[model samples]
Target: MRQPERERPTWTFLTHHARVLLEIARNPEVRLREVASGIGITERTVQIIVNDLRAAGYLDRERVGRRNRYSLNTELRFRYPTEADVPVRRLIDMFADRR
Candidate 1:
């Protein structure tokens, strides 16, 4: 029998960020716990990545009661393929209607 492909190391790779953003975009109201579970990464890493994205002007999230509403800026250009197709700012705007 063939063995299953091993999971990739998220920290060592950059595509993880894009993948994470896509997931968040799919469900703006996704919780940290759910994100960590869905992405197969630690919550700490999720927090770090999220902070990095915000710092890079890739995303903007608003506080909605106890949860957050995220927006994806699909206009700003990204330096890498991890953000090639979509703009960082566009992602932030996706949640504009939430708050």
Candidate 2:
């Protein structure tokens, strides 16, 4: 018998979104495949998160060359249960400042 695929945890989704926000903030020109590789998620999942983030006012991305350049709306609050205290802007800034 074939084994069933394991379901992704809820935290995985949240982390994916957070990582997506950070990636866009830092480069604003990253490819979905890169994001997927960095976050250990599939490209399709990243796309879904991008759509959700955009709808939630967390990201505003545009096409640039073959990749997408993004503008994160850091002012937006997270809709996820975790990392609710930290605003998107603060999260991205925190990550950037570490460099």
Best by lDDT, which number? 2
TM-score of each: 0.67, 0.72
Global Cα RMSD, each model? 7.0, 6.1
Candidate 2 local lDDT, 1-99, one digit each (tens): 322346544454346677777776767787888878776779999999999988888788788777678887777776668857767777677785543
Worst 10 residues of 1 by lDDT: 1-10
Residue-level lDDT of model 1, residues 40-83, one tens digit each, is 77888888888887887777899999889887666668776886
What TM value does model 1 have? 0.67
Candidate 2, overall lDDT? 0.74
- Residue 77 in candidate 1, Cα distance off native in Å: 1.4
